[model samples]
Target: MLINVCNLNNNHELSTTEMNGQFVQSQLQIASLLKMETTSTDQKEFICKCRELYKDNKTQLHFVDEFER
Candidate 1:
């Protein structure tokens, strides 16, 4: 059996599938660092709450406060 994936391009710019995959993997690693058993769970309540509080906040400021060293 074989699976095929097609790259979608928009406005002459190719979508960065490789970069997206890497970003997803990085997110999984971050989730693991949080001791999360699954990325999708009610345990994500904390993330939801934080988003609600800072939805318009710049990520750089938040990341420096939350994760970046």
Candidate 2:
């Protein structure tokens, strides 16, 4: 259950169960937001906001996993 949020353009890893749960919830929220009948520009703005939130809360970023190809 090691989810790599960075792979999804995030800067953190969902290492713990709690963090993973939050990640899932965040993803669901993003999906719901995207589903709204908004303009493309608004969708992009929402995505940027989500990314900023993740980036600000990220603790372990820019670390390369040697085993990952």
Assess every candidate by TM-score. Answer: 0.30, 0.35
Judging by TM-score against the true structure, name the best candidate.
2
Clashing pairs in 1: none
Best by lDDT: 1
All candidates' lDDT scores?
A: 0.55, 0.54
What value does the lDDT take at residue 33 in candidate 2? 63
The candidate 2 region of ten consecutive residues with least summed lDDT is 60-69
Q: What residue runs in model 2 are displaced by over 4 Å at the alpha carbon?
A: 1-15, 39-69
lDDT (Cα, tens digit) per residue for candidate 2, span 1-69: 123343454435446775677778879877876687867776566556555555755542222122121
For model 2, what is the alpha-carbon lDDT of residue 16? Answer: 72
